[model samples]
Target: MSNWLLPESLADILPAEARRIEELRRGLLDLYRTYGFELVAPPLVEYIESLLSGTGADLNLRTCKLIDQVSGRTLGVRADMTPQVSRIDAHLLNREGVTRLCYCGTVLHARPAGLLSDRELLQIGAEIFGHSGVEADIEVIELALASVKRAGVQHARVDLNHPGVLRSIIDSDPALADFADRIHELLGTKDVPGLTELGTQISGVQTGSIQALIQLASLYGTTGVITKARSVLPALPALHAALDDLDVLIAALPGHEFSIDLADMGSGYGYHSGVVFSIYAHGWHDALVRGGRYDGVGRAFGRSRPATGFSLDLRKLSSGLPAAPVAKAIRAPWGTDAALVDALCKLRAAGEIVVQMLPGQLQWLDEFTVDRELVPDGGTWKVRAIA
Candidate 1:
């Protein structure tokens, strides 16, 4: 068998891409700090039980698990950092009030989904625990939008939905369970015909409501769609309240664009209890960032802290981002003068990446095309050949 191999859905982050990702990561970390979110770095590996303590079945299934030889207990490579943060809040911090924690790291998932079809993912996000108010939700949403903008993603839309409405509808008819999942999928795809067909199989499915949701998904304009959705789903108080909260958030963020998906915009995580939202950009059909309130998830760890946060798929965002500006090579002066070495050291110390040539390799260095040249004079260096 061939020795060279890599697991499926996993790949290395090589030079240029890795450097660009690092720069983007540093920018996001600084932004998070400016927003008053304290940074935290949780261990990459954790006890399997603790790691999977509150994460739902879907996430548990996607977690990579193995026996920890040191402790003789099962350990899991974290699939998501949010759950780890929750554990930290519940166990480590042990403080009762709200806390804002930010993190940037690699989360390993066993299965790939949608745009995140990878075993290893670069995740950067924050979690606000111990707050349940719409204000907390608004803060998370605003931060999410701002972070996307900071990442240079234009034309990004934040789609908002409430799981309670769908839960209520699903509770009304137990038989609708089978069709419910399909309906949510169709809603995401904006498959009106598919939803209509699924609606036929379930009793009291409210074809009109389903149609309204489908129409809302199709609605692409500004805040006008919110008013139209309100007109369609008038009786759903939870939905209306959610829309009101959206309006408050929208009013606060005049510069950003948002849309409301009244139908059950299903979430990957079952833990999300209240208002759920996802951020999408022009090129990606799936969300680049997603999060929602998980009040119960906290309680599972005996904390009962209400929380709302989001994690950005950095890989997807990087893929959608414009290529980084290429680095220019610096040509060293021709002669073994002390000034040339001093200049090279200065450039290297100034954080400029440099390429050095060995003795007699200067001819090859000249043959190698470069973007810039460094000529040493009496005591200073001159920059030439910038092109």
Candidate 2:
């Protein structure tokens, strides 16, 4: 086997793609900063318990675990950064008022999320803690929309759902309790036949619950689906509250297209407590952004706080965008003379790309284009257009 061969679903990002990903990272982080979100970076690895706290089983399956050399305790490479950020907000910062935080880091997944996904992701996101209102949900959703827009994604749409709606219905019948996770999976794929099989196979499963699951499958479309859900779904207050939450978000964010999927569970993390949403654009096969209200994820850290936030993989985001333009550069010959050194410093300080050539070095730059040259003209260095 070739030594340079990488594992499936993992590949090294070369100069062009790496530069584009970096640019997107900087722009998104700067955007988060403008919203008053203070940046935070959690450790790349932590004790398994701390890393997996308050998240779903899916995250556990994705996390790569190892033995700690010092304590012999199990450690986990984080597959998601949200829980780690929650721990920080709850234990480290411990602020009493509404606290906004942002983070950018690399996450390792044990397996690829999808056919086209890389196991490694550059995850970047912003979170709002200490506020549980629909207002906080609105703010995060707006920021998520703004993020893809800042990345030049057009025709973006938001699909909203409330896991509580389905969760309440499942809770209404005790027989469905043990199969909750399986039911969520079936509903997520809108697998009506799979759900029907579940109804026939499970002992003591309620006929009404199975019927509601089937009905919920088709309850995805425009805002009108919310009204249809009320009529079709069981008359449970929690279910209605979930629908109301989606309604409020739609009202709060007018002029943006929205679709409601009552059956859609969530990001599989299972911590979302209120209105959850995904941002989708045309070019991407999957969602560009995912976020929502997760008010109690901090409980495991001994301090529960109302939190809402969203995150997206910068690598995935960069993959769908148009290719980044080659950076223009002023090619200069290597020299230690005071005048040449000063000229190079001044050009760099003035925000110019200056590539100094080494003796016998090849001029190969896929990431930059030498559009001009720095040369000695009449005992002074001058930048002239390259011919």
Candidate 3:
């Protein structure tokens, strides 16, 4: 007999942790509902073609692939929920103006190189389809901030950026377009020397703007930093416009701490047309939540809709946050007093944490300082405190 078990990167959530996750999930869903995003659960698996739409190669490689014998077609475990939700809006809902949807599910991503630490992660997210303007983007960011607060992630930082700023620069300089991959690598690694060397290669490149953007990447803290960024690259209108949009979002979220990172920080999603951002907590090294705008993804599915969203890596957040409180046990006296048994059963059924006491357990209860005691009476159970 072979002893096989779950993979290393995967995990099984048990009792208290699972309960905490469910409670957090419900809280987030309730928060999403307040913002008018109805809940929707997409399948865990889908046809490869459908799942592949709009997602980049990095994400595609992570998908767990399999061949469906019945249909004789390739299928994939969804690497992320965004593509599936997009499919729903395009094919099922078919709404044109605007559709706000929320989802909580598990996504499987196989990273052979193990670049990402986890293969199976629980994701909770919300998507707003059929909205293109900056207002929609702001709304998404605001909602994300609210959700994180509701989840009890203290001292979170919302780092905002836009792909358009980098895309515009690359488009203007054809030579730089070829070095896009290298530039992204440098940005990711914060290799300033390498970025400077690469910057020197492009003839007539705007070093001022590039340097400003690089400097902005390290900027953290309040709205006042935007003024400093504006001073550095005042001539670049796209950067200026992105800053303005950020100001609007900042004003909307006065309670949240925000900063701007312009070094082209992102997940390498090609469909992201504008305004990408990530959320980080005080303790976690990586972003707890990440998302942005993708206006062209729906068009690929024959539905020209603009959408924006953010998803939380629930497992990661759970690990970083404080531990959940455990329910205290309620001890009942021994002897199967029918009435007492029925009362304890009712308490258990009512979801109150309870524990049955053994014959000599009363002494143990005194030693342990148990929370409550149930005494069997003729037709009733008397509840008392043992403190």
Candidate 4:
């Protein structure tokens, strides 16, 4: 194997893609700032307990662990930044009122999420802590939609679900407690037959509960599924509450297309509590954004604040879009003359891309197009269009 070869499911992001990703990150952080969201950054690695705080077992499997030489404790490379942000909101800031925070950083996933996914991800997102109202959910959802739109994604589709819906159903029957994981796995794929088989095989499992699970699996489509869910599922308040959350979100978010899948447990990380959502668009095989309310996340950090947010891999987002155009640049001959040096500095200060050619060096720029040239116009350097 060549030394230059990266591990499977990982690759270097070249100049064009890196530029696009960086621009998107800056634009998104600025957009979040406009919404009054302050930026926060957590460490890339921390104690395993701190990194995985409040997040479920799924993130545990995704995290890459190493023994810290300084403390001799297990440190985990973050697979997701949400929990760390929650810790900051819960422990460090300790603000009583609503606090909005945004962040951008790289995350290392132990395994690729899919065949097309890379193990390393540039995750960027925003979170609102201490607000449990559907209003906060609304704010997060709106911002997420705005993010993709700003990235030039066309015809973005939104999907809404509440994990509490399925969670409530599973909790209603004690007999189904031990089989929760398997149940979620089946429902994730909408494997109705597998669910039925589990129902028949498991001793003391209620027939009605299994039947309801099957019905929920099929309860996917337009927003109408929310209404359909109320009639078909059990009359548990928690279940209805989850359905109500979805109904409110549909009413709150207008002008964007939405689909509902009552069965999707959402990243299967188990922290999602209310009104979960995902954004999908053409050219991306998976969701471009995933976010929801996980009010309990802060509890593991000593405070239980109502938190809602969303994140997406900037690399993935950039890869799905059309190629970014080569940046137009002004090329200048390298020289130590004060006037020439001054001209280069002034152009760069004005946000112009200036490329200085070395002596006898070939003009080569894969990421930039030299459309203009700096020349000695009589005495002072001036920029002119290249013929």
Candidate 5:
């Protein structure tokens, strides 16, 4: 006999954690409903082409690929469900007006994205398609914040960004091309020394633009960050427009603590083309929620629609919750008594969990916190709290 060993970053979720995950899943979906977002479930796997059509393009290396047995085409285990949801919004639903959709499911990755991570993560998110405006961005951002609150997570901050700002600067300058990747990396870390060294290497690249770009790395915190950026960042028309969009977002999010991070450059997947945002809890290094405007993610579906969405790992949020309310059961002994059967059915129908204890299953009753027992009370069965 061979011993079974699970792959790295793959493990079974015990009952307690599973329960919490399920609870948060329901909590998040319920929250989306209040905003009129309809829930949709895409498949766990799909044709490689359609699966990687939109944001999935950024997830090419992350997805697990296999040949489809029936169609002889390639299939991919979804690395991200946002692309699939976009497909639904474009082809299946085909609504001309704005379409808001939410989904919860497990997405499989070829390998763990981080040192301590899972290959399969439960992803929950909401996306709005067809509206290309800062209003959609605000709605997604607000929903992201509301999701954290609903998950019982406290003291978290959402850092906002417009990757287009930095991207615009890179694309506009030919000298910045070779050093683009390194500069973007350095900027994200606020590495002044690295930027200085690199800037010194690129001769005659306009000291003003280089200095302004370096300044962006340090520009974060409050609405003042946007004001500061407008003054420091290069006066490119694209940069100015992106800053204006930032101002709108800041004004809309008054009283909500958020910081600007122009150097973020969107998610690791790089699908975000407009406003990008990530939420980080007080103690956690990783963002609990990440999403943004990928306005044309549905382009591959033959119909381009503006899209913005946010997704988080339910398993991660589950652990952050204080506790899950476990269900208590009423233990009913095995019997043919009409009174007992009717009592059990009625109790179950009324939403009270009644567990019928089989001959040898009495021990299992204790496992579910069986706090009550059904017993005969003057010829009528009644429930009494176990003492």
Candidate 6:
């Protein structure tokens, strides 16, 4: 095997894609700023305890562990930045009012989530701490959609799932507890055969509930899906409340395409307590953006504040973008003339990309090779376009 072989699912990003990712990052961060969200950066690695403290056991499983030579304690490369952000809101900043925070960075997951996903993802996300109400949830969902819109994904569809409703179904009957995991797995993957078998395993009141839940796995298409669930599912308080939450969202976002997937079960990131949403664009097979509420994620730090947020991999999001624009740069050759140096600096300050050439070095930047060159004519610096 080649010594340079990268581990499975971990690879480098090339210049073209890297430029697109950075552009998306800046635009999304700017959009966050418009929503009054402040930017924050957390260290890539942290004490395992702090990093994995409150997110969930799933986060712990994905975290790559290491020994800190200086402290002689185990540290973990962050698999998710949510827990770290929670710590900041609850422990460090401890801001009194509702805090709006945004972050963009690379997170290392031990395994790739799917065939299309990467092990190392450039995560861009926003968090709202100190808000538990559904209004906060609405804001998060809106922001997620807005970010994708800003990324130029025109045909994105969002599927909203409420696990609490299913949680209620599972908790309502004690006998159904034995088959919960299998049921969740079947429901999430839409395994009708497995679900049919699971339905047979349950008896009495739980039997009817299991069958009703199983049928929902196939009930996804349009807004009517939500209405159908309200009409068909057994009337439970949790399900009723969750439907109302969905109602508010549907009303708030009129015209946008959204579907309700009640059977969307828990994942490795376990703390999501409310409506979890996934956005799928036309070309991408997987979700381009995802987030939900994790009310008590900060408990391990000190306070268990109400929190909700959304995150999208910059690479994945950019993959759905219409096209990557080429970089525009001006080539500056080596010269002793003070005017040439001053002109180069001025061009850079004015937001123009200026690439200065070194002595005896051939300028071979073919990509983004603009015809425009900085040349001096009649003792004056000017940008002249070559034929």
Provide TM-scores for the models. Answer: 0.82, 0.97, 0.85, 0.97, 0.92, 0.93
Report lDDT (Cα) of residue 372, candidate 6. Answer: 72
What candidate 2 gets wrong by more than 4 Å, as runs, is 266-269
The per-residue C-alpha lDDT of model 6 at residue 109 equals 93
Task: Write down the lDDT of every candidate, Cα atoms only.
Answer: 0.75, 0.92, 0.77, 0.91, 0.84, 0.83
Candidates 4 and 5 compared: the better one by lDDT is 4
* Model 1 poorest ten-residue lDDT run: 361-370
Question: Tens-digit lDDT track for model 3 on 237-352?
Answer: 77677677777777877777787766656565266877888998887778888989888677667887888999987777777777766766677766665677788889889887
Candidate 1 residue-wise lDDT at 291: 81
Between candidates 2 and 5, which one is better according to lDDT? 2
Q: How far is candidate 5 from the true structure (C-alpha RMSD, Å)?
A: 2.3
Best-performing candidate as measured by lDDT? 2
Shift in Å, residue 248, candidate 3: 1.8
Segments in model 3 whose C-alpha atoms lie over 4 Å from true places: 1-5, 112-116, 199-225, 234-236, 332-351, 355-370
Model 2 vs truth, CA RMSD? 1.4
Of candidates 4 and 1, the better by lDDT: 4
Per-residue alpha-carbon lDDT of model 4 for 16-125, expressed as tens digits?
Answer: 77888899999999999999999998999999988888888889999999999999999999999999999999999999999999999999999998888899999999
Question: What is the C-alpha local distance difference test score of candidate 5?
Answer: 0.84
Which rank order by TM-score, best down to worst?
A: 4, 2, 6, 5, 3, 1
Better of 2 and 5 by TM-score: 2
Stretches of candidate 4 exceeding 4 Å from the true structure = none
Each prediction's total of clashing residue pairs, residues at least 3 apart in sequence or on different chains, is 0, 0, 0, 0, 0, 0
> Between which residue pairs do clashes occur in model 1?
none
- Model 2, residue 297: what's the lDDT? 90
Encode model 2's per-residue lDDT on 300-387: one tens digit a residue. Answer: 9999999999999999999998888899999999999899999999999999999999999898899999999999988889999988
